[model samples]
Target: MHKNKNIKAITSFPALKGRLKQLTLCALSGALLLSVSACSEQASQTPEQAKADFEAAYNSISTERLKNDIRVLSSDEFEGRLPTTEGETKTLDFLTAGFTEAGFKPGNGDSFFQQVDLMQITADPDMTLRIGENEFVYKVNMVASSKREVPSIELSESPIVFLGYGVNAPEYDWNDYDQVDVSGKTVIVLVNDPGFAAADSGKFQGSTMTYYGRWSYKYEEASRQGADAVFIVHETAPASYGWSVVANSWSGPQYGLVSPDQGQSRVKVEGWLSRDAAIKVFADAGLDFDQEKEKALQGPYSQALDLSASVTVNNSIEKSKSYNVFASLPGSELPDEHIIYTAHWDHLGKDETKDGDQIYNGAHDNATGTAAIIEMARAFASLEVAPKRTISMLVVTAEEQGLLGSKYYAENPIIPLDKTVANINMDAMNILGPTKDVSVVGMGKSELESYLEKAATNQGRVLTQEDRPEAGYYYRSDHFSFAKLGVPALYAKGGSQPINDEIAQYRKRMNVIVTGCYHQVCDQFRETWNFEGITEDTQLLFEVGYDLANTSDWPQWNATSEFQR
Candidate 1:
């Protein structure tokens, strides 16, 4: 059973001002100050005094507090914390109170909420895809949806073209759509990049998937090629998950930022086809899937199959507002420069069609990360004096919906990209016991990783790369939004190595949780789950951000990184 804390109602502007005034009379005030005497006092402290001050603040991150917050947020009453719903309202209120309690002022001007206007399109499940004489059912062999905010979208026997991986990377000198006009046609693409298929060190980054391998890039490139519809053939090993992940993720109400032309710039239809169904389609065209894939690895490949695809998507569209919640511990000296921490605050909402459990309580998926941010705020607030640069915490919405909220923030930023020092993102935190090593997602992307390594070293833990680099977990999260725009972003957590031999059992359980319950209804808060690992990871991130905030240095992306400015 979960217990919801009876948090006080959100403080009004006048009351908030009074609270700030009262806090200013005390040490380490919550209010943002440009030139406070407390800054001088903090600067005057000896090294020993400063270390004691840091320890006091760092030790304030309580595992019990994090556990309770996750329990409350992931409870059924939150309705899976979906954006633009009653769940969103409750989540906003809860976060507003949490930020207030943590002594953080609104990062956005006079408001904690940054309203992100979105177009929500829920597609009808009762749809069919016809490939010549063969027919495939929705959620069975195929899952497709239209980004275009229209009542219905249809394709009538559009010519099908196999466009290899559908990647147009100029740096790699690879373009599958080269000399091929896919205008007004449907295209079939393979998941991941040719690097994974070829397994050759010279191709792309060998097994390490690049941004070109992402499905979003595929859809975007197809749109640029004027393709009416595009479908990626899904394979479990390359895509890193089962067909259920695609089916469950795409079947829901999809959200995109409100566009001027109602997403007309995007392809009319985009989705995935099960590998089995794709093989059948290839066979129908008198082609073998394995043989074609092998040929695709050699170089650019495209062929006009003798099949035509026809499908229609009936969508229920609603124009509404979701929010990116922001709260900050402003700097005393360099208020303009900011060190931002981000975590997504959304998950798959309730599904009425399911038998008993319908809510996707995304406890491990994000609740742990969100809770850690709130705790980090408290740690910052407990400092003897504010950091030199502002510490901003942003909890974005609709991350489960293709990172819409963060994308909106990145495109329309409150803090200028040039002024932003670094972005530390937390997602799906470790819930098993502590580990001897910390894992860096998309390692070697930026210099911000060095700070993480230093922090991990202080904790007696080493740094390691993610076990599954081929999964492309980097592009799948909110940090990718910042990285794409040149800001250095770090996403790391407890690596797989257990702290001691006694915790081997927890590691086995973690594997089961990550593989079995991801994006499913079973992703609920478990009482047996350990919070020590998440707590340590939170502290490590806090140390990194805290160090960055106090220093004048701005970490940049590695020269070899694709996201380099």
Candidate 2:
């Protein structure tokens, strides 16, 4: 018998009162009925038995084991787990060992590793920008594009065009590229969509950023137009984060696909400039940066300013190799078909600036997520009845580096695309506390919603929409890579409301975890971590994978979804 005393609630608050009452009544009623239904008392189990089985599996997930793994992975010794470093070897070895111990067979036959060839471009920190004798150093104001390391590129005194949102969506009948030729010059644009500015705002989906509004889209569009360079002006509200975050994020070594079939990205240089620095650049050219930004926000606006600027970026490029660890549990009936569970194993690596502390040990960001998959593998392996389809447990690399691992996997899948049913991705699990609902990041975008609804229902939970859609989190994760290829991918939700607490306070605490610990050193493990929520989340995910693995149904894309058509 499992000990109930070990499963005490971590905190006591008011919001859990209703949920506790409901759970108690349901359990009691269920137990009584289950007791009566047993024709032979020895042959039947009570409702508590079922719940207890789930809880035992949940509680069996040792937070200490998770913490120990994280402690080593994130410790300075691991060197931030950056690809092409000693840490990569250590991380991969650790993951493979864990999978082997969990009884998962080699996913890629004869090997547990998937070799990903990549190009690493490390740019010089001392890049110089000069616009007709008006010069500004790189770090102080602007950063160059990640595409290539050009020692020096001259920009002929060309006109600077202001394009609204810089998006072209024929479906929405909106195009920032309409009536504008940005060839041979730089284009200035805003971050996110106009809806973000006013909610009911612009020609584009008001505050919600369309694909065109994404910075990556803007750079691609500029490249297609044969523009010299692209500069995106950064603001917190519109961009969803501060300039410091962007600067620190892009300053490190970046990764890109190194396949024979990959097409060239258009723009030679693509990057961002701080609002203050942009103001100075505009001022030097005798143009008003604020006015230009405001005009760019309005629809169908286009203007050319003679802001002749020249930038010289000096950097070194190197090619390196990364690995995506894979393991599988083959199904009984449809052995070839698969349902993938993905979690990124890489983090920011090490930053020497933080005194003696260095390793990024992505515990909550993904180590927790990775561990969840391992536990799920254990659960599925324990089932008496084997699934009808194969289950692939994928730990991708370079997610923090820009979803390179997943993107690589999508382009070159070990399993054919058509046979792959759904990609269930776990980026960061909720370590906070249990809540009334599980939040879906990109809610209502696909048929995966229906699948999640069924899974949540089984756990006595409900599905909820993302709390901050403006953040554009759906486009930020490894799942988006698979989604881009028309694969139905599900990113599972973590605990939001505490098992016993005020909903508002729980929300506040949740935000703190996302903002403060998300990409920081403070994300390390704790002795006080209840792991109750982790256990619940892990069990819920196993149920989802089990359902997908056993059922013959193919999860489809929603009709309204952009990927469906």
Candidate 3:
């Protein structure tokens, strides 16, 4: 959902929030140039010109309609749009009505909903973690969870191992796990990568983060090592979020992609420890935590720590149900092939314990995106002739719980993967007015960039590469669920190029949103909010899908992309 520059640097999207699963942000701008080279040669105009002709129709997507959708969806009446609650019923009904009004059919083969079976586990109070003689209080000193469907997970006095960056990249000749067996230990790893500390572009893609730096990768690697637990050390600078984010995330019910074996393959304990707590643990073991951390960034510094830790987690879990909204505008020429648009409709729901306003009211966090997708559905249906490839719009649930709904859709796609053309995902929509460039989260990963570039040129705007590769925004979104299965996906945000002399103001806006609004109760919409940016980005995306729907060409991941597999 969001990306950061690197652990040490704050370049593009630095303050981007990492929610329960890092739900993401962004937007774009510019105007198309029109020319009259020949008064009599209208048919010979360029493809750009052809799209310019249709620009008016694309612009027909009124801001009033967009505002209306956001206003209604994010309203307190919906109860923050949580899943398996009254919110789910109201949201589903609203979406189904919108799709039906737009002349779309149920994409789930005779049903407007796609069933996703999930298990919700709420961590009970009094969770305990002990390191040597020091006991780390839950939420205050440590936080943990297990994906496995069990009432409790208890690890007795597990040995701690220090894994440098916890990465095993053969291409980079880096294997932090070498020369040691971590079969039954807890791996203590740093956030981000060594390249971030060195500020050298040559080291693990320099400041831009690769998949290896993501926390998800750390846990996966731990599972591979047959470790009982994985604890990622959280530093404000490197992690791009404060301790509060972790505390809030780990305090509640967490959901996972329910496995056939009830996540039997996942690690028993995955958690985070505050930097201060990690430092204390090292000092108690007679090691200088700072010196050890410095060695971690110096390259190839993996060793076993002399610390022993114990973890215990008890959960009050209940089985729950959620639905993925799938509706389609069937293509005229090749209805079987499809172009999909996705945006998650679920937020943190409502938190009654929090003081002041308890409603998370994710107006901009995702109501903007969810509303925008439905608006696009309306536009596609109103077209004089249907697009060549079917346009499927998906409003998924439980993205806040780690892209669960999207993952389910990818694993159990209503349409076969082979026939799916491409996917375009919209996270938080741009609210910072118009700009000169559009931000593509993974610009060079696939041939879809060319299509996006073409559309940008048609609108007289340039493409901006994702500024925070370190944040792993590309892997954080719902689109990633499709990309892992070989589908070329474009997950992007509005560009940073502010129009007029508003660069400073734009930065200020992003800072406020990043620091305060994300996943917080203050994320509600404003009456004075400028939605033109969201409108422009939506239209640009519509044009991209419109082009792909009408063309026979298929988008492919670049040869260098890891997802090419």
Candidate 4:
């Protein structure tokens, strides 16, 4: 996203400066006039007339095709579509072929791929957490990873400190690092902010889990404090996930963008310890973990513990190039302005260390979302008229790896951000059936909500905001990357309505997938999935985009939105 550049006036005389200023104002006014005229012309288009053929093309999106795509993508052949793997090549080829078949042209200078450089780090730690003389085994007691650039980590007898939430928000008049000389030591931090612990939503964005609550923040704060290592004590409730989810995700091939300084500014190691392990470690230093934790969060408090630990990590690093797939339908009027659709095409690759089924197929996790976008692309191509603004479908990689692909695109957008109208991001859409309501995550943040609501209403559906704000879903998806740059984005899922009357059934199925199959090898394609829901969800997306396309009105973030310019 390019920032606005200031233009200076050229003056040859004392009176010329004022005259030049007048001329510049006139030019700017003329430009504004042209822009407003164009906007009015486009915004005046009859929605009913423009969308007359929209339903037809949207109907052309076949349930069978979507199902077939998901089936293959989540199958054993693609190897979970991990970035920088054989599976990546196959996935990219599949998306490109689909785009070609759907009347889309190559978006990146006659190439469908935009190369993204990424680095993979797998930590094989010969680690032991020693509290005085008592030693605990790694992985079982604690699992560690690193963002540092080095190949290995060695920290022996580093003293420990307990910092509640590990937040340093001067705005909130709080600093956990206050009165601490933490140089070259380790910091033991809590998982989430006090908002969750206090069961008070009014505290720290009201149980919404501010950025300070994230474990990544803990590590970064520790680094800023010049700590050698950071270990976050994990509690399922505050973390909003089970410890196994942490173990599975952090233990394998961890990834990060190629840092400019090769991550030298980062702490040597970052990890998590189970509550029991944390208790034992604290107790070994003649302190009770639970009691200390209560005091730590009491404000204006921090403790330099007598506890010390040591570990050594041997890392296997691999650097490679992956891609974000861009397929475009050139605009009939405004070729430079764009409406972007993004879905991640990558999932966690096969974990051979697992027993039998090794691949984390990510069927409902994201394969379904990727398939939906392809079907949407096909639908847009089948439309009677080309959109007024370019419509691009982007299948990004490494979303499961903490939104790496999307972050890269945000930093290096193929198109200028100011010219980009809006982004529609789909991840793990509804596979249950049709619904009377459509769900929008971060619903109130932008004008796109009105567009989405109108489109959903036309289809006899209501709009629903995210039910669980505590999960902080708006910050977790690829859409956040665009939103952070002040681009109006709608991050949606199929949650508002379900066709089936058995209310408990949908939740049961979803819970089973979430708790058991999410990020696990069991997330394979299922024969029982009903694609009608996702198909309808895709239709809603198409209609909303159609509404945006015929109108030149650029959506803007609401005044209350954090990303508002």
Assess every candidate by TM-score.
0.87, 0.80, 0.84, 0.80
Candidates ranked, most accurate by TM-score first: 1, 3, 2, 4
lDDT per residue (tens digit) for residues 1-565 in model 2: 0000001112222221232111110124445532111011224335576455545544466655655665566666766666656667677777777776655777777577787776655666776666556666665667775475344445556567767677766655667789788888888777887667767654545555555567877887888887878888888888888877777656655556674633244565677877887777777667787787677666656666566666655555656677898888767668789999998887776666668655566677777787777777766654333466888898998787678899999999999889999998887777666666788887777777777788788778888877777777778889988988989988767645555655446557656655666666677755545555666677677777767876789988765455665
Candidate 2, pairs of clashing residues: 74-361, 80-349, 195-206, 195-207, 196-207, 223-267, 434-497, 435-497
Q: Give residue 198's lDDT in candidate 3 (0 to 100).
A: 74
lDDT of 4 by residue, 10-76 (tens): 2222221222111110124444532221122333336685656676786798999999999988989
- Candidate lDDT scores, in order, read 0.85, 0.69, 0.79, 0.77
Total clashes, candidate 3? Answer: 11
Segments in model 2 whose C-alpha atoms lie over 4 Å from true places: 1-79, 131-136, 149-152, 201-205, 259-264, 276-301, 351-354, 502-515
Better of 3 and 4 by TM-score: 3
Query: What ordering of candidates by lDDT runs from best to worst?
Result: 1, 3, 4, 2
Best by lDDT: 1
List the lowest-lDDT window of 10 residues for candidate 2.
Answer: 1-10
Clashes of each: 0, 8, 11, 1
**Candidate 1 residue 393 C-alpha distance from true site, Å:** 0.1
lDDT (C-alpha) at residue 186 in model 4: 86
Clashing pairs in 4: 201-206
Clashing pairs in 1: none
**Residue 362 of model 2: what lDDT?**
68
Where is model 1 more than 4 Å wrong at Cα?
Answer: 1-49, 132-135, 276-287, 306-308, 349-359, 506-515, 520-522
Residue 260 error, candidate 1, Å: 2.6
